[model samples]
Target: MSAGTIALTNNSATVSGTGTVFTTDLKANDFIVVIVGGVTYTLGVKATASATSLTLITPYGGPTATGNAWTAVPNATLVGITAQVAADVAKAIRGLNLDKANWQQVFSGTGTITVTLPDGSTYSGPAWNSLTTLLNNKAAKGANSDITSISGLTTALTIEQGGTGAKTAAAARAALGAFSTAGGAVSGSITAGAAAGIAVAAGENNRVEINNVTSGVGAGNPVGWTVYRWYTELAQTGIRRAGDTTIQSYFVALSGGGGWEFLRGGNATASGTWTSGSDIRHKFDIEKVKNALASVLTFNGSIYGKKDGGREVGLIAQDVERACKEAITYNGDRKFSDGTVIPNFKYLNTAGAAAAYHTEAIKTLFELVELALDKPDDARALIASIKEQSEVIKNTPIENEDPRKEAPPIFDVPSSEDYEEPTT
Candidate 1:
C-alpha cells in the first residue's frame, strides 16, 4: 500500500490529497480506502492520478469529511469474503514459522494440488515439503532398508536363526565370530557347567586340544575328567579293514607296553573265528615237547569269585609263575585305592601260555593207540615166516640128523620189562 493522507468531500466524486505523491505512488483504477465519520469507504479511481487531486468512479460514499487517512491499492477481482457458518478450529496454531511450516501435505489418490507458494507462485502439483520428511524417514531405523546398523534393542536374535544371539554389545560382537556347520566347518560341543566356547582349527595338521582346567575346590570336589571318543573304524588296534589294507583306529596309551587296546562295556561274542597270528615265520626256536603230562598236572586251576562280580575258575598268576614264569605278566600301570602308585598286578596268560603242554599230551596219546592197532598184523607175519623155516629144516634132515638137538634148542626167551624213564 502507498503511504498518503487525503481529503474527502461529502457526496462528491472529487477527492484531493495533502502530502500524498499520487503520481509516483498511486495509479489509475486503484481503490482509495479511507475512514470518515467512524465509517470506511473503498472508492475506485475514475481518472489518471495527479500530484494533488484524483477522481473516484462515483460519489463519496461515507459522510462528508475534510482530511482523512487512506491507502491506495491496485484493483483485483476478489473484493470481500462473507461466511456465516465457518467453524473455528480451537486447536489452530495462531502463528507459524515460515522456515519450519513445511506441512508435508499428502493425498492418497492421484489429483492435482495447486498450491499458492510462499512467494506467491503457483504449481499444479508440488513435490516439496518432502525433503524434511524424507530426511527424517531415511534416518529412522525401521522405516526402510537404509538403516545399516541399529542399537538399543530389548531382544536378541539367535545365530542359528541368522542373527547374533546376544543381549549385550560385547556378546553380540563375539557371537558374530561363530560359524555354522552348513558352512563346511566342524561343529561340536565341549562345555563346562554353564560356560561354553569353541575352538576352530583349519586343517588336519592343526591339533585339537583337550585342555585340563583347574580343579574345583571343596570337601567333595571333582578331580578328573573322562573323555569318550568315537571313530569311523569298526575294528580296533592292529587289525586291518576286512577287505582293505588300512589299519583300524587304535587306542594307544603309554601304559600296557604301548600296545593298542579295544575297550567296551561288555563281553564280545563273535560270529566268526578270531585268529591270532601264529605263523612260524613270525616265531623262532621251535622244538618237540617232552613230559607234557607232568606239565599239565602242575597247573592248579580253582574256582573263585572275581572282584568284578562274577564266578570264574582260573589259575592264580603267582601260583602259575612258580611252575612256569613265562605264563605270568606284571601290569605296569596300577594304583592303590588311596591313589598311591603300584605295579605288582600279575596278569596271567590264560588263553595261550599252557596250551602247548596239553596239546603235546594229546598228540602222544594218539600215537600210542596207533601202535597198538598194528601189533596183531605184525604177529601173524612172524608166525608165517617161522612155518616156512620149519619146512626147510625137514627137507635138510638127512644131512644134519639134528632133529632132536634142534627141538631141544627150541625153548623161548622171556619178553622185555615195562618201559621207564632212563637215569640221568
Candidate 2:
C-alpha cells in the first residue's frame, strides 16, 4: 500500500497519487487497487511512471474521481501448479456448478461436444452433442421403439418412442413443448439449487410450486400454502393456509381495514355468508341454544367509534368477552411501535360462539314468546281491557294538551334522520 489520496482522469492511462511511494512498492505488471465510492477497482500497472504516479495499460473507464485510497498487489504466485492446471481446476468446478443447478445452453446451430471418460478415453459423435442426449436417443427406458443398428440412429426417434421426433436440439425442444401430460415441467424447468430463476416473457403464466420430492414439505411445516395477488394501484391481497381447510384454520384478507388484518375461516366461504356444520354424522353432542335471551340482554348494542376514525354499531370485544367469552377471540398480545401493548381480538359475529356464555337467557326469552302464543284467549281479554281504558282517556280533555291535536295511539318505528325535537 502506497498512496493516501489519488486522482484518475477518465479515459487516461495515468494514476496520480499524493504522498505516495509508487516506484518503491509497485513494478511493471503489478496491479493497484483503488477504492472509489466504496467500490474497489483493480487496475494493472503498465509501468512505474514515478514515485507519485503509476501508468495503467488500460485507461480508467469509470467516472473521474480524486482523493481515492489505493493499494498495490503483485500478480498472484501459483504454488505447485502451472497456469494450465489452475484453469482446468476452475473449469471442472464450473462444470459441477452447472450440473447441480440444471443449467443448459440452447443452440440452434450445429455443434459438437467431446466427452472424456475416467478411463482417459474421449469420444465425439457427429449427430449427438451431449452424453445425456446421446444416451436418451439410444436407450429405451419405457415401452418404446429401439434403434437396432448404428445407421438407424442417424435420424432422431419418433414421439411414440419418447424422443422429440426432431433432428436438431432446438427443434426437439420446441416439439417437446406440445407434450404437457406430466408431473414435472417439460419445456422450461429450473431444478433445485438454482441461484437465479428463469425469466418469463409477457403473456406467460408464472407458477410457484412446491413439489413433494424436491424442496417442498419440511419440518414444522407439513402442509403450508400461500396464494398472492399483486395490485398496482392498491395494496396486495392474499389467502394463506396453515393446516387442512376442513377445520377453521384457513385465513383470508377480506379488505383493507385498520391494518388489513386477515380473518380466520373454514370450509365456509369468507365472502359474505357463513355456514355452520350441523350434520349429526359430524357432531358429537349437540343441543339447542340456551341462555340466548340472557346473552341478548347482556349485549350492550351501543354506538362506538373505531380506531380508524369511523363510528360503528356493535358491542366492544372486551365488554362482550366479559358477558359472552365465546364471542370474543384472543390472538395473543399486540405490541405497538410506541411501546403500547394490548391484547388483540377477533369477533366472529355470525358464529354460534358469539351467542355463548349463557343459553338460559335465550331460553327464557323463548319461553316468554311461547307463553304469548299459547294463551290467546287471556291475551284477547287483556287487549279488550286496554282498549276500554284508552277510549276513556281519549274522551276526557287533558289540562296541558292542545285541543286540536287529538288522535289515537300510533305505533311505528321512527328513523333517526326523520325524528325532530318536540316543541314546548
lDDT of 1: 0.52
**lDDT (0 to 1) per candidate:** 0.52, 0.54
Reference-based TM-score of each model: 0.29, 0.26
Q: Give the alpha carbon lDDT tens digit for every residue of 1-424 in model 1.
A: 4556777777888888787877765677777778777777778888755888888889886776766778776665314211211222321222233223333333331233454455656556534444444354433564565656544445676887667888766677567754444343434432543322233344533422232331343322212222222332222122222223332222332222333433221123333455789898988887654445444555567997743235667776654454456666766644433344434556788766567756875775565456547885755554455355434432332111111111122225542223333454
Q: Tell me the number of clashing residue pairs for each predicted model.
A: 0, 11
Tens digits of per-residue lDDT, candidate 2, 13-89, equal 99898888888888887888777766778888898878888789899977899888777777663223448798889
Stretches of candidate 2 off by over 4 Å are: 1-206, 209-276, 337-339, 344-350, 353-366, 369-424
